[model samples]
Target: MISTRLQDAINEQINKEFFSAYLYLSMGQYFESKFLRGIAHWFYVQYKEELKHAEKFISFLNEKGGRVILNGIPAPKVEWNGALDAFNEAYNHEKFITSSIEDIMKIAVEENDFSTQNLLNWFLDEQVEEEAQTLEIVKKLELVGEHGQALYMLDRELAQRQG
Candidate 1:
């Protein structure tokens, strides 16, 4: 957050990260209502991770001598009729997040902020992993289709996700 432009970008990202947490929490509730404990557990972990991400940005901004401006996060929708629907939503969300990281990268490059660019490089790689994981979950849900036993088994697999 060396420049005002970068500061604005960081603030916007912080807001997005908070929204991500809320979004995952919504998905957690959706999974619970569907009796998908493993999926719910996964979303819970995701929510925690997003919060951690937000704090990381917040701390970085402060350390860089930028003022942290907190913004209100919109409430996320809490309904997904099936695992497929929920995962499709997650996939789209990851796409949106990837774009956000790309935009930050662009800003870092445009401002010639080598330190910021170095930091953004991490996000660039992280977005790839994020999209891949979400897409994998979507594909798994698609393959599981209407098979309740398979879905449950998959949920159990997801429940083991840590950090």
Candidate 2:
């Protein structure tokens, strides 16, 4: 059985994951509005991935016999200055999520919750990939700054991303 504190933390993380999905979806819409279809598709994929992350947490919590009480997700920012801005925001959010997972890992350690700690390790590794990918995109966008052809090529490359 999960401790009450750990359970509450897991519930909070689940809600955050949902919010991440919402934020990515909103960004996807923003890209669509800009007519960057490939970028939009990428964000759509990210949005779906975030939902899967939430479901994974939910399943873990259920397996631990913990009650999950979902909280409301706040509105995500829909307007970005450009692709660079969107990717920067995403990279920042990934950093925030990494910190959150670390906080939960600390709690799990404190509570001697080995199972929860094990599960969080997966998230920790995921965040590393998440942050790396976003940052890499940010760098590429930076290089393509104010270059229309380059941006177009990058968009085409991004569109080829599968899953």
Candidate 3:
């Protein structure tokens, strides 16, 4: 059985994942309002993917016979300064998530929960990709530096992203 502390943390992580989805969807709406359809579409896809991640954690908990006590998600920021700002926020959030995953791994180590640790291995690898993606976008945005046409082009490129 998973420790209550560990289960609670994991449950909280699940909520955060859902919150991420909500946040991205909100960003998508904002982008659409700005008439940046490509960016909006990219965020919409990202939102769906984040929801999938939340569900994955939920299912993993269920498979482990742990109760998923969902908690409330905090409100996400509504206003972004611009496309670059929004993506920078996303990149920062991804970093936070990466650290959280690392902390969970530390807890697993302390508990000697080999099974839990093994399961988290997948997340560790996934986090690498997550960080890479967000960082890439941030770098590209930085390079473009307030260039609308370039931003639009990047959006077009991102819109091609598929699961």
Candidate 4:
């Protein structure tokens, strides 16, 4: 049986994952409004991936015989200065998520929940990739600043991203 504390923490994480999906979906719409279809597509993929993350947590909770209590997701920002601004937010959010997972990992360790620790280890590695990917885009956007042609090429490159 899952401890109440760990169950509560996982429930909170599930809400956060859902919020992330909503945030990315909002960003996708923002990019679409700016006519940056490729960038929008990238955010759309991010949205889907976040939904999957939430579902993964839900599955884990079920497997552990824990109750899944969902909370409301606050609305995400609908505007950004540009792709760079959006990606910077993304990078920061990933950092926040990493911290959250670490907190949960700490609780798991305290409780001696080896299975939860193993699950969180996967998320920890995934967070590294998530942060790296967003940071890379931020750097590329920095280089492509105010350069329409360069941004266009980058958009084309991003369009090739599959899911």
Candidate 5:
């Protein structure tokens, strides 16, 4: 069985993951409004991935004999200065998520909860990929600044992303 502290932490993470999904979906809508279909598609995929992450946490908590308690998700920002600004926010959000996962891992270690530690190990690796992917987009957007053609090309490349 999971400890109350760990259960609470996982529940909080599930909410954050859901918020991440909402944020990405909002970003996708922003891109769609800007007529950047490819970029919007990319954010759509991110939204799906975040939803899956939340589900994964829910399943894990259930498997550990813990109750799942969901909370309300706050509204995400609906506007950005540009693609670069949006991607920068995404990168920063990923960093924040990475830190959150690390905090859970630390708790698991302190409590000698091997199962939770093992689960968090996967999240730690996933967070690395998440941060790296967003940071790469931020860098690419930086390079394409004020270059409509370059931004369009990058959008095309990003649209090719699957799942």
Candidate 6:
């Protein structure tokens, strides 16, 4: 059985995961509006992955006999100065997520909940990869510096993302 404090924290994280999905979806739409199809596709893939992450938490909660309570997802910002601006936001968002996972891990450790700690460990590792990928894109965008051809090339590269 899950402790009340842990259960509440997990439920909150579930809501956060859903909000992350929504944010990525909004970024996808923004890219589409700018006619950056490949970038849009990349954000769409991220959106789906976020949904899967939320489902993982939901399933874990159920398995632990905890209540699943979802909250409303606030609207995400739909505009950016350009591709660099958007990818920078993405990178920042990943950092925020990493911090959130760390907070949860702290809670699990304090409560001596090894099961929850094990589950969060996966997310902690994932957050590292997530931040790295987004930051790489951000760095490339910075180097390209508003160059139309370079941006197009980057878009094509991002299009290769699968699942």
- TM-scores for all candidates: the values are 0.95, 0.97, 0.94, 0.98, 0.98, 0.98
Predicted candidate 1 versus true structure: per-residue lDDT over 26-114, tens digit per residue: 99988888888899999999899889888988888898899999989998998876888888888898899879978988988998988
What is the C-alpha lDDT profile of model 4 across 1-163, one tens digit per residue? 8999999999999999999999999999998998888999999999999999999999999999999999999999999998899999999999999999999999999999999999999999999999998899999989878367988887777787788
Candidate 2 local lDDT, 1-163, one digit each (tens): 9999999989999999999999999999998998899999989999999999999999999999999899999999989998999999999999999999999999999998999999999999999999999999999888768358988887888898778
What does the lDDT read for residue 77 in candidate 6?
Answer: 95
Least accurate 10 contiguous residues by lDDT in model 6 = 140-149
Model 6, runs deviating above 4 Å: none
- In the range 60-102, model 5's lDDT, one tens digit per residue, is 9999999999999999999999889999999999999989889
Tens-digit lDDT string for candidate 3 (32-112): 998888888888988998898889888888888899998888888889999889999988888888788778888889999
Model 5, residue 102: distance off in Å is 0.5
Q: Cα lDDT of all candidates, in order?
A: 0.87, 0.93, 0.86, 0.93, 0.93, 0.93
**Residues 1-163, model 6: lDDT tens digits:** 9999899988998998999999999999999998889999999999999999999999999999999998899999999998889899999998988888899889899999999999999999999999999999999888887567998899899999998
lDDT of residue 12 for candidate 4: 99
Give candidate 1 regions above 4 Å deviation: none
Q: How many backbone clashes does candidate 2 have?
A: 0
Clash count list over all predictions: 0, 0, 0, 0, 0, 0
Model 3 lDDT, residue 25, Cα: 95
Regions of candidate 2 where Cα sits further than 4 Å from its true position = none
CA RMSD, predictions in order: 1.2, 0.8, 1.2, 0.8, 0.8, 0.7
